[model samples]
Target chain A: MSQVANRHDALDVVGAQWQAVSPRLVTLRRLSLSIVLVPAIVVLVIVLAVTQMWWPGLVAAALLVLWLLACVLIGRQVRAIRYARRDDDLVIRKGVLARRLVVIPYGRMQTVDVSVGPLERRFGLASLQFQTASASTNATLPGLVATEAQSVREELVRLGEKRMRRL
Target chain B: MTGLEPSISDEAASPLQWHRVHPATPLVRMWVALVALALFTLREVDELVSGGYREILALAVSWTAWAVLVGVIAAILTGFYISWRCTGYAVDDERIHFKQGVVWRTERTAPLDKIETIDVRRPLAARLIGLSQLRIEVAGGKDSYLELGFLRLADANVLRDELLTVARLHDRRPGAVTTPEAGIAAEHSSIPVEDALYEPSAVAAQHVLTIPNSRLFAAALLSGEFVTSVGVVIGGVIAVVITGSFATLAGVAALLWGFGGGAVKRFTRNFGFVVTKSDQGLRIGRGLFDHTMQSVPTERIHAIEVRQTVLHRLCQWWQIRATIAGYGEEGDETMLVPVATSDEVLNFLAHFGARWTDEQTIALLVQGMAGDRHQAGDAFQAVPQRARLWDPLGWVRQGHWADDDQVWLRHGRLQRAVSVIELAHCQSASVVQGPLDRKRSLASVEFGLVSGPVSKALDHLDESVAVDLAERSVAEDRRFRQAATAVAGKSGQVL
Candidate 1:
């Protein structure tokens, strides 16, 4: 918790608080990347076998291992991300290597969904999905504990409702 | 009017309970399912004759399982009839209540003031049966309204008239004088309720266009499966001629026959499309065997598209479709019309309060920007450097000021497209980013419109520019809406 606070303080120093997302979500991120890579590895092996190229198979395996390592490193970095609410907007700052900052105004929020998948369910963790009217633009803050996710969703909804009523 | 009792208060009596009055014959929707089952059985029998005894035995066991399906369908039909008889709706001075469902009965109640629009639809089969379906749309979620299917035609009309009268009376300003009962009595005595409610004057002039049967047939022919089947049939014919393989030829012939049958079924189901102008909105009713009636309000329309295929252009015909709010089972509910002339389109636009300037400059800009060619003209504006780089489709070219107030965007392929976004309707604008978009430093800016349910989006712009433009647009819209609302209030109109 102290480390998390220090990380947030560091993010604030850079004036990029909105780029923060939950650090614990790194587990889910790693799992998703692994799932994606399994099919790619299978396809690569099949292609190499079909071509009867031993060196190509070795190269493909090497690339897969490198990709997996990169993903794990990025996942660990993402796990350190955190977000905070500031006045009428929520700020998310994320990414270890290529950081991103997103500021979503409460009035623009259409729906706030708190979803817990099978793995997240075991860890009592959930993902907060923020939907806006524009289908193309959506923000997700994944890997918060279930209770925290619910609280965030409720806060966002209340803010959104207030904004709608003002309009 | 004199004999009618005063409006009943909700405190005095229970709200009317609505029932689901489905067709007495549930066989209509079930017939296809049954037919499919029977065909499956026949296929199994054919397989058994061809040395697939195990498949035949498995199919026979499944035939018993299908009995439950038949029973369930029959029960549903019976339940529908029973519920229809039992269901009723009542609107008191304050609340409207409806009761429905079969085994698990449900009741819904909402305030009368919450009602936005009441639609009454009569499909071909329902019309023949002298029945109509009534749906009430309200402000909440998609299913906020009550739907009562298969009401007697006369009863439906009476209900519609009564509801309309109540709505009008409730909406009347406080100081406005109520019309004398004598006038009401006179009007009611002379004009039938159906005629009064469904008068031609109540129908808007802009008729929705439906896609023609011939076009649908062309589309079917162009479908992947259709093309593949044709190829297979041609290949089989050539094979038979070259090698005299009777077995292969026979199999191909069967496949061809099945494909033809499927095409015929498709053609038959989509026959006799009609676009009817109704008081609620534009009702696009189509489908031969399985009827579909979709109503799109004029206010909810986002964009209207008029397209002409090469064949349609040669025939001097065009198809018009509108992007509307709300999701339907079939994705976008498109209304198809057989033919629409250019003159007719102008007239339709005028009726819908859309400006149709015949200025050659406007036309030239539309042609030059919407088309692939970059024709140099004094009237034409240059495409923004940011926009040109972002839009790979290159469909969206120059967006320029139109009539000093509106911004016009010209985009589309072959048919050519033009859109005029009024500053008044523009709400919040934003720049969107995806992984790919971030890499390109390009974003999509969406403009939220005030149109009910349906909103239009303008995509692809520089992120910073999009945010600035959106903020400005939203501010302008707010000011415009405020002024418009003030004027409406002064006029004693409920906007």
Candidate 2:
């Protein structure tokens, strides 16, 4: 009876919440996107002011507008990102207008990598990447709180070992 | 440069003794390149000199020039000799070690178990020199596969068998030695051949399938490439007649060359292909110029596909390819059978444990291929009518079926192929929906397969159905695995 309970426990994903990532993810993406924007704007301004090239100025204005629109979209994109941890699988949901949900079972999990970039570390954020035998099916849960990411990685590693299956 | 993690190397026992490769290993390759280069240089000289062939020949053979060329060749040979000296490898029961480089030192250790497949490959040049290369494939992205080359052919084969025997845990007694040297020396020196005691002398080989040279050639002629080339040639001639400009013929010639070359490559890659079965696993042997023998334990094969084009259907022929965990090159499908008749295909599939010898199953396959899948009576679950909006040509035929643990996806119009993968053996399962799919309340389900003979999806099912399928497959996969373990007969082979 206990073994049957344990077997059913592996399918326990009914009421799991899709936990949202750190809101700072938006700021991180916006900052990174702006890093490229600043240099291009600087060059465009100098080229336009010195050469009096209207085309360069026009291009720069268009790029600035597009970058601002992207900044807005990035905020929504970050807000929409969420993940759920089940007994046997991990579920990732992202996108606003067109949503995409990916479910990966722990049994198929080969490696769980926790990465903290300089910018992410500064913001106390980390990312966890999942690898499987199939190279193309890798999924990443980015912008988790650093400590949460570490604990989740450990939990996943435990589940992966428990649910290990030959590929 | 091709090394494993430093931590793994640390855990491994240090290499016992280093063995150097055969001296002729680098010479054959370098010699070929040098001869090609010399011929090219002579051709260029002949073109440049107004005196043509005679003057170029005289200039090429001038005493000083001849001396310089010979000196260069000598220097290269010496470099190769030093390289051969510097490069060395050592293998133990648990790991293989490679130590190479002079200025930039490098050492690599690969655990015996992580090895996917061990192939004894003999390129034409290497074979001529009685040498072979042992290719060890591990599951890393690129530059992951390691090769030990320029060894005597017998030494390579013995080493391969010995390594696989240990790595696969086929034997517990660690049959001859912990080193290739002892094994090779034992085989070469006229000892009592005690090592042969451990090695299975010979099992009555099961001759599964053999594609004749004539059949292979005929298949190539009926292939899509040849058909396309014929069409292109006819169009090129018609266009030439209409425009009356012969330069347009260049386009036709180039396309023809491309098609013919590809078909010829496919043909030769599968030339004299033969598949045989033993108690251990399947022995796949092919290649005319660089014969390769790949032994894939049936248990290691995760996925398989049987395909037929329109012309192939007319000829009642099919091609079979399989996905062995470490046997396939990263992004390319390995051909298990280039071409075989329906009966041969059925026989081959049976070896993989698919009980499909009956007339009913053959009829099921024929219906699944081209007939209305609905007539199969629950043998397949096809796409809904609305899904036809997505695949205008093949939507009606697109379906998925689960026979025992094997989940099969069937799709394709002009070229119909059925890919069968045991879900329990697959890596992962996923469901995705694009904007269009979302609007239609539909989604696609895909199973993650290791690199080879496994690239397909169950496309255009209801969103709910797709998600439910993906989620349920996880449990089904787990259940099958556990039950399979409990039974655990000679896994991979039916007998």
Candidate 3:
């Protein structure tokens, strides 16, 4: 009883093997942001050139600063993401400012999907997504080594099947 | 993944046959899409007619445009026809199969034994066309279901009965066909294309409860919608005072929805609502214009929640809801009692075999007991007085009870509620902490129901208490499941 009380005294503890996502996830996040942001910035700079206004140049600089801030935020967000496999459930901890730890039981899990986008594939990473009975419990573990993601998906499916069979 | 392949028995000697939906189905499904396309085309034609082209030949362009329009219409019709031809459904002895789409094809199947509910829906267009869609709700979750859309109304009803019959028969004996359900299904399935007709099978369900019009009206008046409406109206008045202008569409819409829309929706959905209980399970028949029949078996129910909004609390009324597997956001169907007294709510739960014999209620520091004195007692484990600031009026009411086969939770301030969750049906349990909670060393325990949108909670407990509650609830759930499995192993009967 004392151990249980002490374990949950600190809020951040999930107790065991909470692994952070691959550090390359930061690069993937930055790359995806730049792909969208770079084009928008270029379009804004072109508009500024056409308008030939000093204030517009200031606006373009402000936009560039916003872009840099977004990149930093994305990096922090990717870093904050972590996951752990429990005895009967999977726990995903995410978010920097308003943190959320979603725990999904194996019995409740319906599907374990692996999604890989072109950029993610180029970076040798895949996202493992879990679809549970409840929408809120559903979670995605982004930026895993492709093989690791596959193994996790296989393990989850196996565990889910076993639990459901017992039911 | 579980629903991809159709479930079939080892002795299935009959060849699997594929059949398409009615010819009118494609037209019905794509009518809205086609209408929008036509509207866009009409706007383009208007643009061409109104604009003056100085360098181009207007007469030649007009002729080309007409030709293009004709060709596009022909192409669309051909595509619809091809898509309709490709889409098909079949009834196997062990499963219901559906294959749809042209480019991105999907193959969906639902096992006979796992089928939860079979619904026959008739939309306005389908009604006019004398067609109905047979929706098969299965146990595996949201996406693991099949719909055989736009079959003849009679055929649809027969098909629903057939599937249900097969499922029931399967339940009684896994592979044996001693009953007449499979026989009827087989006979109906073998009917030729031109003469597919079967009589509406009489459903075997006993009349349980029929809500009177007066109670329905009271429920509407005491609903969360009514309270929300009142709040919105006050907010609108405040906004008008602040802005000194009424040029807000949102304000008008909010005002309209708060009063009339909410009341109307409640009245229409619950008007002439009736509940029936049978060996198959419980069925709720509701709706004024859009008549609906929702069915769920007794064992399929995940959890039963009893709530009281502020207005209802003042009136000593309670609303009881059941969360069944595979139902997502469909409110009226699961609501066993819309508005009833606390005693009445207990009686209703008794009818469903989830009677909480021990009466208990914690005295809130503020907003003390409202009504029905005999129904209230003290059984809940309360949060500390230090947590009072977290929920001023409701902090004392935030408590839980875990014993036997049930976990009882009490919460809410002006609108107090006591949600009764069966330990056997709970999907998951966890202790959640936020930044504010961490500062105060407080946490909340949430129990996830198998179905429904939100989790049941005992909010803002001491950190240690929350952890204890979570562990106890999980242990209870595990014990319940283990016992159920043991019973099944001994008797080959699953409850």
What local distance difference test score does each model get?
Answer: 0.53, 0.71, 0.66
Please report, as a residue range, the 10-residue window in candidate 1 chain B with the lowest summed lDDT: B174-183
In the range B302-396, model 1's lDDT, one tens digit per residue, is: 44545554444454455455543232112324333434565555444443433444455335434532344355553533344555555656434
Candidate 2 per-residue C-alpha lDDT over B20-100 given as tens digits, one digit per residue, 9 for 90 to 100: 878886676567887788899777766767776777678767897688778987988788888778777787655777766
Task: Provide C-alpha RMSD values for all models, in order.
Answer: 11.6, 8.1, 10.9
DockQ of each: 0.06, 0.29, 0.11
- Candidate 1 CAPRI level: incorrect
Sorted by DockQ (best first), the order is 2, 3, 1
Please give, for residues B1-495, the per-residue lDDT of candidate 3 as tens digits: 344355443335766688778888987787788889989977776676665654235745667766887899899889989888888887766667787889988777787777767666666567678887877777665565677888887777567766665565554441222122332343335443223213334467687777787888877876767767777777777888898988664866767665768787898877787777665566676777555666566656667667777776667776777776555556556676677666565555544643433333223211122322123555566676777787777875777667655677777667666666765556556667777776677877777665663337777888777766555544653454454455445546443
**Highest-scoring model, DockQ:** 2
Q: State which candidate has the highest TM-score.
A: 2
First chain TM-score for all predictions: 0.68, 0.87, 0.86
Best by lDDT: 2
Q: Is the docking of candidate 3 incorrect, acceptable, medium or high quality?
A: incorrect
Tens-digit lDDT track of model 2 for A18-129: 6889888899999989999979988998999999979989989998998999999999998777777776678877777666666788877889999999999989999999
What TM value does chain B of candidate 2 have?
A: 0.78
